[model samples]
Target chain A: MNTPNTSPSPEVTRTYRRLIPNTWWLKQRSTILFMIREWSSVFVALYAICLLGQLWALSEGPERYNALLAKSLSGGSLLLHLVMGAFVLYHMVTWFKISGRIFGSGPLSPGAVTAVNYVVWIAASIGVFYWIF
Target chain B: MCLIKFIKSLEPLWWSLFGLGGAIAAFLFPAHILIQGVLIPAGILPKDMLQYENFAGLLSSPIVRIYFLALIVFPLYHAAHRIRMTLEDLRIGWLNAILPLLCYGGATTISIAAVVVILRLS
Candidate 1:
């Protein structure tokens, strides 16, 4: 007995599915947002390293440390602060938006997970405020 | 666990507010003495220290240190989690375990290091 061919016909082209959604707006916005978030990490890391260096200087001696500190407080430092400040704000907002997605409860219940996230966020804000101020 | 999650959830907003507040203070109040007098001429910091140190110091003060630590630790946790998701989104399945471990491990190391420095300073 002859077997029938199962291969695709010559006129047909193979189709590929996208991992992400097909909405053009969503794809563009998400790509932009992702780039912002990823690059912001680098800035945050830079800020962390600067802090470590400050700590090192303070550990060394007063005069040297104070001078280094003074320089950062003046001139172009102000401008840099403005830029980093914006990036940091963006970072914070995006972080919160993504928080629920990261640690949400598995398929058991959806709203329950979101509720838990909001509660935690509010409580943390209160606690940090109390501690800081 | 709930309490921890609550704090974790609030972290990004809290940090954003704090960072913004600190940035404003850095500009309006202008810790000129701290930056120009101590950080700049002293010659130990990286070139960018001219821009970073004052804001960082303001954000990294003793009280702020606690906040900073929380922000650092939690944001990193958040980052790791998000990164894992992104990897999976991209169909990079094998890295799931390693990514989280490295992220949390690095975060913990940094937190410990910061704590040590803070304690030494105090």
Candidate 2:
């Protein structure tokens, strides 16, 4: 067995340790899923940026805003949205499943929290839809 | 040392933002995506609904302003955090010191811009 060096090794040249595989996340199903879930953020960030652009366009006035809106509705943007939407949907679904872990596992159970999450989500979205359209 | 400690202390802040953003993203983003991506594209929701006048009018409401602000901003920080973690998971250890700063800084800058835009929209 190699003995531990309690003292500092300022003068000693330490050998480089073997690095973790870049694909280490692929070793486990959960880790792979988590990585994919994390990837959803890229799309989220893209959409957020686009929305900010829309806000800027709104600030610009009706003509520019209309142009931006038209661009967003074009074929390219639609395809982008479909792809991004899939990722975001995956993100949302996984998030609901694990939200209890984030907020703290309080008196309410995870399942209950998830149920409440879905309920609130549906209600709020419907409310927003009504308010907006 | 103090600077390091300060940076270290930001962990909780980042984590909290990540959780909050995740919650918002899960709860509200789907509806927005469906409307903007599917309904609007398919013409089921008339293009007029997204017209400048209509959208601007919709955003003029205080509640809608707040909702849009939240919707646009939180996910940014959340994405930053996730991107940082994803990089770490990729075994990019050399970037440890700078990654958080870059990611969170970008998110902060954009969030501030978003807030300003939302505030000025009315």
Candidate 3:
């Protein structure tokens, strides 16, 4: 039996070089991370629009408002709420991960920036709770 | 880096934060019944009412106004930023310059309009 060459051909090496640079791996990883960060917004946007619809129904009439509200609070809505909750959590995590990359140093420390996010989120939650009740 | 160029780059950060912040606020909170139900439907509200606000009454409240401002301002910024990023990703060479300008310019316009309406209400 004749032994085959183990080394790759020069043409294959050139093709590989064209296909991916030394830094391509890092770029690929970053791009995937970026996509994850970006696409999470879809869930966030959908739920937000649903909330807007509820608001619209409320403005329309009590009957419509109550119906929408009931739908929103129904089991199906609850399931959606759970999904959205998970999505938002992912959003928050990825958001912070990219935050440093996006927002360079400013007056606020990284800790301070993160604290602001939590505080703002908590405050919004309280506002909504008060409004709903 | 040129001052203008540096400022331009920071635009993405501003927009992203604004968008993310607005999305977070909108999702987590239920619409305020009084605002969304009573005031907005009543047609007594300002035109620029937030989903949570049925009317402009909340605009009078400083705290509520701040929240509203944050919601409006950040989302537009986020949208603009995302649009710019999308364009950059496509690697369309010629359109790059005009794309960011339009995105940022449009965002600025909307922000101004919102501020104008809010200030007028006040």
Pick the DockQ winner.
Answer: 2
Q: Where is model 1 chain B poorest over a 10-residue stretch in terms of lDDT?
A: B24-33
Rank candidates, lDDT, best first. Answer: 2, 3, 1
Best by TM-score: 2
Top lDDT hit: 2
Q: What's the lDDT for residue B71 in model 3? A: 53
Order candidates by TM-score, high to low.
Answer: 2, 3, 1
Docking quality category of candidate 1 according to DockQ thresholds:
incorrect
Per-residue C-alpha lDDT of model 2 across residues B1-122, encoded as one tens digit per residue: 45545655799999988888887877777787788877898788888788777888888898988878888889998999999888976877778767777788899999999988887887
TM-score for chain A, candidates 1 onward in order: 0.58, 0.79, 0.60
Q: What ranges in model 2 sit over 4 Å off? A: A1-18, A100-108, B1-5
Docking class of 2: medium
As a whole number from 0 to 100, the lDDT of residue A55 in candidate 1 is 62
List model 1 lDDT by residue over B21-113, tens digit each. Answer: 333222211222233333344443344543444444554567766655544444444444444445545555566545545544565577677
lDDT of 1: 0.50
Candidate 3 lDDT tens digits, B13-100: 7655765654543444333322343344445554244333444344456665556555555555665666567656655668776776
Give the better candidate number (1 or 3) by TM-score.
Answer: 3
Off by over 4 Å in 1: A1-27, A74-80, A95-133, B1-65, B87-97
**Total residue pair clashes for candidate 3:** 7
Of candidate 2 chain A, the 10-residue stretch with the lowest lDDT total is A1-10
DockQ-superior candidate, 1 or 2: 2
